[model samples]
Structure formats: structure tokens, C-alpha cells
Target: MTEPNSKDPAPSPLGRRERLLLAAIAAALGLLLFQLRGGLQPQAPLEQMARRSLELPVALANGRPTILEFYADWCAVCRSMAPAVEAIETKHRGALDVVLLNVDNPRWAAEIERYDVNGIPQLEFFDREGQSVGRSLGGRSLAELDAIATALIAGKPLPRLAGVGSLSQLDVASTPVAGPRSHG
Candidate 1:
């Protein structure tokens, strides 16, 4: 090291106060990134959605349009799509009946077979005449659910869904659909 030259103007190392300010700025950035992580992923349960379990034959016999929601308690897609489904129910109120069928529950085993419910979050629609309208599998956006419910109430053609297969009145004669992964 050379002798100290107090008169010479040179860049000095960061003082303790400066170091602390940098650390605080870095910590704030870290916190911001952490918050952004949550914003990046698909968020579920938009609101506390209200749904009710149902008995298939009885619910269908009520002489109203029915939407059978096949789900399992452990299913993430079911949990997430819940608020949207509830919105449909709230939208259609008296004219439509929303049925919650827990696939894991033995009570709904027969319904599971009748609908060939291999995937969770399946939204099955039935017209007032007790005819099958269509069924949507996997995750569905709020708009999709809204469309289906609106169409169902108006007796219009149900919107076709992608990623997961859907069954319409015209396609009921086709073969059944098998295993499909659920969403979160």
C-alpha cells in the first residue's frame, strides 16, 4: 500500500450508509418479484362460489334445465372453476338447476358411469325436456361458462369447447370420451 494521500481526489469504497441503502433497494425489488410471481400463474376461485350436491335422476326430473358439474374434492380445476359455475347459477337462478356431483363420492358412481366422467370439472348440460345439451370437460373461463349458461337458458346451441371434448345433441351418437387430465 502507498502512503495515504488525503489531498488526492479518488473514488472511495461505498460507505456503510450507502451499502445499507443498496441492500434496502435490492430487498424491495425482491419483494416486488415475489408478488409478481403470484400474478403470473392462473388464479382460481375468483370468488366464494356457491354450489350444491345433487341426486341425478331426481334433479333431472324437476322439469328444468340442469347443469351437472362432476368434480372431486381434491381437484384443482373444480376448485378454481367454482366461482364461474356459481355465477352461471346466479345468472340463471330459477330457470336452471346446477348440480354438483362429486366423482369420489360413491353416491354419484352411477351418474359417473352414465356421463362417462373420466375427467373432473365436467360441466354437463341438459335441456328442460330432459335432453342432453352438451358437456364441457376440464377448466373453463368465466366467459365460457357464462356463454353456456346463457345459451342453455335461451335454448340456443351451446358453445363448443376446445382442449377438452364436448358432447352436443347432434354428436350424442358418437363414441364416448376417455381419460383427460384436470387443471389447476
Candidate 2:
């Protein structure tokens, strides 16, 4: 204590072990925050199905029954139905094909028009021979979806459900109804 040596440094309040512990805690908190910020979170069901979906052309030509879902990222009904669609896809991975087309994506504009997608989440069901069998025009419960999938897989008629209808081509002349407000 003889006037402490000039070269001596002051001791840190925290010991080396304490500092290490603090650093570890800080790192853990940072990681947790990153996860909370969605950096490490699992993908949403819609995104997961989209990522795993096969192309429309490929799915159509694969000699398997196919389900085409027209959806948009911002569509709440579509998001709500994503989990059921995903489950159907997973459950019929080999026997059937599930394809997702985002309505917001310009690449699917032709399909959007082809399918007459005035509203979503529209689902078009195709048979093994790639023929359009039926279409569902709105969100459906899991049981309804599963029933549809099961019928399609078994080559049976789709279950009779609201918003569900068989698809077919018709040859007829059409004319727009003339009205004061009609643009056609």
C-alpha cells in the first residue's frame, strides 16, 4: 500500500467468470429476440404449402388426381384453410398432387382467369386423367376438405357440400344482360 505502483491497473468490479456469464446471458437473449422477430420461426402453413407445391403443369401430367388451390397471401380465408390443405397434401403425397397458385402472382393470371376465380380460396379438383371434376368456391371445414379428397382419391363423386360443384364444359351462345349500369 506504499502509494500503489504506477503501472498497476484497477481491478474490474466483475470477475472473469461473472463477465462470461453475463455475456452468455446477453447472447441467449439476442437469440431469443431473433426468434421472436421471426428470423428463426417456423414458416406459416400457407408458405410451407406453397414452397412444397408442385408446378401446375407437372402436377397435371403426373397421372395422379390433383387439387389446385387459388389463394393470395393476404387472403384470411386462404390462410385459415392452409393447414387443412397441407394435411391433405401430406396424407396423399404419392396418390394425389396438391398445387398452390398465388392469385397475387402475375404468373398465374391465365389460370386465375381460366378457373374463373372471382373469389377465393377456390379449389379445383382434377381426376387421374387430368379432367376437371369439381370446384369449391370458398373456405371449407377440414371434414369437408377431407371428404372431397377422399372421394377424389377413390374415384367417387365429390361429397355434396355448399359451395362445391362439378365442373363441365358447355357449348352455348352467351350475351350480357343489358342494363343501365352494365359495362358490357
Superposed by TM-score, candidate 1 places the C-alpha of residue 118 at a distance from the truth, in angstroms, of 0.8
How does residue 153 of candidate 1 score in lDDT?
78
Query: What are the per-residue Cα lDDT tens digits for candidate 1 across 13-38?
Result: 99889999999999999988877766
Worst 10 residues of 2 by lDDT: 167-176
Error of 1 at 157 (Å): 1.0
Candidate 1 error regions (>4 Å): 1-54, 165-184
RMSD of each: 12.6, 11.3
Report clash pairs, candidate 1: none
**Superposed Cα deviation of residue 172, candidate 2 (Å):** 26
lDDT of 1 at 35: 78
Alpha-carbon runs more than 4 Å astray in model 2: 1-37, 164-184
Give me the displacement of residue 180 in model 2, in angstroms. Answer: 39
* Per-model TM against the reference: 0.59, 0.68
Which digits, one per residue and each the tens of the lDDT, describe model 2 over residues 160-184? 9974433222211221233556431
